[model samples]
Target: MTLYLCFCLAMALFSGPGAILALAPENEVPLHPTTWLGENKVTPVHLPKGRTRRLYFTLKKRADLMSVTVSPCAVPIEWSLAVRTLKDKPPKKPHWSSKKSMPEVWWRGSAREVRIYSYTGNDVDTYTGPVYAPASIYILRLKSNEQNTKVSAYIHEGPGPSGAFPELPSDPKVHILGVGMTSVTLSWSPSSSVVVKDGHHGSLPYHEYCVLVNHKHNYQSLCAAREGIRKERQNVQKRERREKPGKEIVWATLKDWWWQQPDALEDHASSLWDNPEDPGCVCRDVESVCTVSDLLPETQYYFDVFVVDRVNGTNAAYTGTFARTHKEARQAVTSLREGQVKWVTLSGDASSQKGEQLFRFKPRGWQQNGLLTLHTCNGTSKVKVTISSKGQVLSSEEVGHQLAQIWLHGGPSYRLQIQALVQSSSSSSISKGDSNKSKFCLKMQASSAYHRRAAPVFPATLQIKSFNKLRTCNSITIAWMGTEERSLYCVYRRQIPPDAKDIRHSSTDRCLDPEARPANERVLCKYFQELNPRRAVTTAVIGGLDPGVVYVFDVYLMRRWGLPIKYHSKMVRTRNEC
Candidate 1:
């Protein structure tokens, strides 16, 4: 019986109280020599029932306290842990009740047996404040509930290599594949080596690539703008300090003021891709090639590439180079007198006695002349050309196999009609003696011309209060304040033209027929709706729009005698259809 008792005692001592079993072995342990938690020194402490103990450690550099684990002595015990960063001075003994008043507390929870607490920015339960970068002195408070407990505390550090882990690989090679007016395509070779942190190889499979773009040509302007913003912020801060003599400045107040600046610095930089499947910016085929779009034209841009290890919370040095996108090609509108050629085909069957074709031309700028070349379907047939502007004939000519070139001096609007006459033998005419009557078809092509008009007085500006996206896709609600009473307001909406030159030319056409119905359903505009002018606040819901199309809306107030006075214009793009 004594021998059996000795065996039991030996087993108890071997597997029980002083066994040195790791309570939470999976918890991350710091590996860097400089890390405060890397010392591996165990502080054994005894806490009475319902009592708390606080321990302090100072971080010399910026680091992330990833996790905390507790190894209980012999019996399972209920315990709670909390961490707070001491900014100014360490507080007196802090209890669970005073956790909220601490500068920044990370974890607060109770558990039985071994416990491991991990840190996450989104800690919705206890802390509702911004998760700041870990630095300075940290206080770890441990509490025991209804049971006396002896435990060894272990804190984990992140952002450093541990064990035989390797450092981050060298920067990747980035190359500009192509650069367009509004986009830049970049290709890069992936890092050959892995990044090591927390005594383990980085777990994140994807490396983040950041593309930084700056207008090299406008570098001076950008620097000036940045300086101006800095001065403006400084002036505002000085004014606030003067107004509130000794009041403490809060970070939230300054953050709000910084965001309110029209030219915020953050606007200049953008991420290459926010996520793996970002639609706007595409990183295609093994993620080696990234295409960044929605850039400006005729601008010189300098691009820099950065590789980031997000899981390790570290970034590689920027590998930078500069490239300029080709300037946007301007559309050249050659006038008719300058030998601009445009073709309009007028064709008819043999039974038709006459064929006519109407040509409409809207000039770019200033008054000019147009040239018309009439091509006969039959080489032997003679054709008559008649060009008119606003119901007045500008020219008349006749020619045979040789092309009929007619010079026309017309106003902005022109309509040209052509007539063809074919001489026929009596046998072919079905009348034995008729020679002048015959079946013929005519085709005429007219070149474009430039015309000038006097600029008219524009109407009073219409103040648009707000244009907001609706909950439903493909719709936007616009609200505007009216100035003149009893003014009939017409709202015109159209899709934005793809070409810049088309924008200049279409602006005139959009104004001419703001109420014209569109022939194609795909066309969003040529849309017009009249709003009641008696109301002070004018609001309208523009709907039936094609998804992902940019549209421009023009509000015109009708004057006396039905003349539309251009008022307000705005551009908006509809959301993509889900």
Candidate 2:
């Protein structure tokens, strides 16, 4: 009896408290009974050789188990452990063993003692298992030889209270808010549940969101396959019942086989649905909004959003949406031929002029604001132009390289005045020689009509020979010669009182008070009269001048549609009434 007692004590000491002996009627030995949260007990399970017995256990909430120990009460029992989430369904049975296999199974060798460890916290000895996801069904598939075996599973809880598990995060809701030519904006609702960590009572917020955008082609393939099936069915029904029995049946079968082939459809769909080298844009540590750019314009795109709990390295189900990018806008033409162009001579005359020649020409058909291109016909000259419309000067500047761009408003008549300083030997000779003998001529051209026909040029040069007042105190007579016999002439006169202000003097330099100056200095009081300069010397009389007042007179050589090429100005004091 003493020897028997000593032998039993020796066996107990060798096995120790952490180990369980394989015997009939399997029993679970809990290492830490105080930390025990849950246990799944399986009774005697009989399996054929090379067959597997899968045990499924669903987690009610998030759980961080310290260790999962599976012990076979019978010595000959061999087992393996595997786990899979609810989102990932268990693959079909006769499963092949590979690195890419789902429900990764770790086979514990056929031994009397088998233990798997998962440690939580900073404890070096703590063994930890895979983080069990909440609401996720996990399968602990065990396989063995042909034998009747009993198995028991002990799940050791970590630091938290027993049976207290966090629920899995809710699925995200995705929406495509806006689509641009090369970009798309997306927004989604964050998951409601937080990630539960080991030894912590509270949960951590979702840390990141993964987004995927792909071109949907599987749907198109499915639609086409259905249509092909429908057409094939109709064709089969239309065949006559009296057709050759075996031959017709064989032909119909061949036709049906052609319609059911999935190779072509699958290949087409695969080309479109393949994932890009760089996966879709990911929003790290983000909650809701994300914008993706560099997308193809006018193309359809599919989207998926995943709520991830970075603390636990777990994610929720995918949320999907789709959108199409906008098309690009067309550009406008900028050529002058296809558009309107206005030509105005702002400065130098058609002929060379000495010193400075200042003139203004209001081009016709100046409807819209556009570029102004200038051309220098003669020697190099500096030209400045001032653009004025509706009595307002819009711009005044020196044009560079004889080219200037100006903007003009519609519905208003614009006048462009060009001042050019030209250095020419002929102009200098004309200015230095006898003034009566020298003649200056200028030619002006109108803009082409609808930019189709060449502009018509008109002579605007005229020379005045003599000017004198008649016996009448209110009348005067003048004689002038023009280059063209058919040219017309206009004469203008304005009265100036002795007290009239001199407009040539600057307002700041004038000694008189502001009110003393004439309100209108540049006004022409005499009506313009047209004269036909048909003869070598033409005479015209102006009959409506104020007596005893200083008057300014101007004679202009006119063109049909352009400004005067040459003009003469003279001041005369009329004789007082007798």
Candidate 3:
């Protein structure tokens, strides 16, 4: 400012040598008398450097028809005025340009003479000086042409003249507060007014507002922004809701967001809507006591609510926000209790076939022995069964009419034991000569459900060959088979992967040890590359040992020793005795 003041002063007067001083004689040939003439000389109007400076234009409602002249400082240079109409009709597409700028609302031109006057004639400064001389420049000079500058023509900004909005029925006030995450809380307080002194024709205007976020910075009127949001919302038929016991005198308006195109939903930062009369189009406001069940999971939305009266389409009072719905949580199971029979997909067949595992068990609170157990009723084809771990299955089982009793070692703890229920032990209990089928009484459980727990102590492993007695006596060989990786194994002298292991890939290990070794002992025996599974391994005793001395044998294995059975195939005999 000080720099411009110094330049302007230098322009209209001179402080050079021989310049007429303030005490100079009247008309005594002044040194710079040519620059000074009248009391009010031309000087530059001080303005900011940029042309698009923030400017605010305010208007007051005048009851009578009179005119007022607002004195707006002429843009310093290289700037012009652009006027956008704020009418409530169709949405004019938003636009911008480098050449065609903001409209010129008022310009100095040949408009019916004597009404308005401003600088014209284009001529560049002849003096090539660094400093600007106000009197030498165009437009910059305060008083360029003749008469004490003609007053800008009067504009009757009265209530009703030519181009005036019909009287507003309400005193509309809107508040815009930006919320985080590109959201905002918009609120408005409005009171309706009457159009005529006695009749009911006032603009019962609904206070609608679009954020126009990051849009025109110096918009002069609130009504202009309100109408912009309202006009666009009408096309979409968006609904506006009310908060509570208040009368819906006004329609809810949408949050006006700036966009190049209207159809795309992605880039939109705010939700625009109208009040009911426009129902169900937008989400209901949470403040209005809406139910959670009414919403779907993972939905996106925004809301606008207002009052509607016959007198007023929508009350100016309105509010809105953005929100989403939550998803449903996992469901719980009922009916089935703990310790039930479950079918082990591979309880007995884990080793017969070589392939990847088939199924999985989601362990529940009381799950033990995850094998699929069927009814051990009278009409059943029984097979030798084995098991290792419990508590892995996570779902309940389907109960059937037939009675099934797992060779479960009944104890408080779901532990492992070596035994099998009689009825469930044979393929079919029929006499070979007489062909007589037999039936037996057994205890059956009603129902069961998935429960995760420690594998309860149960009869899983027993070491004996085919049940029928054989004629000749030879060498006794033993082999252990089962994963030594994690499960308990026994020596199944002439056995393979059980029905469950072969199918489910369970960690159930069946061993053929003469004696059921304690869980703490290493069941693994020695491994030989040539020893094939289910192949007999013979050990000869020079002198026949006592006819039936149960001999426990040990072989090297990979299970901290060797994998039993196929890997640990070898034989041992009772102390030799003639």
Compare the candidates by TM-score and give the number of the best one: 2
Q: Report the alpha-carbon TM-score of model 2 versus the true structure.
A: 0.29
Evaluation by TM-score, superior candidate among 1 and 3: 1
How much RMSD separates candidate 2 from the native structure? Answer: 24.2
Residues 1-578, candidate 3: write the lDDT tens digits: 99998885685477653342543553233233232111111121223343222121222342333322212222112222211232232223433333332222111111111111233321111111121111111111222232221111122333332221112224343344433233344444432321222336543222222222312222222222344454556644432333445535343223223312112211221343212132212222112222112233454444333322222121222333445444443232222234332332212222232111222223233532332333322233233323223543223232222322342222222322111223333544445353223322112221222342222221112222221122124334342333222433333222122242332222122232234445433434332322333432322222232343333334322222111221223323333332
The clash count for each model shown is 3, 9, 89
Higher-scoring candidate on TM-score, 1 or 2 = 2
> In terms of TM-score, how similar is model 3 to the real structure?
0.21
Worst 10 residues of 3 by lDDT: 105-114
Off by over 4 Å in 3: 1-524, 531-578
Model 1: colliding residue pairs? 366-451, 366-452, 367-452
Give all candidates' CA lDDT scores.
0.45, 0.44, 0.28
lDDT digits (tens) for residues 8-66 of candidate 1: 77876788754433332422222322223332243455767775565655444445434
Q: Ten-residue segment with the worst summed lDDT in candidate 2?
A: 117-126
Runs of candidate 1 exceeding 4 Å displacement = 1-173, 193-206, 212-279, 284-286, 331-335, 338-578
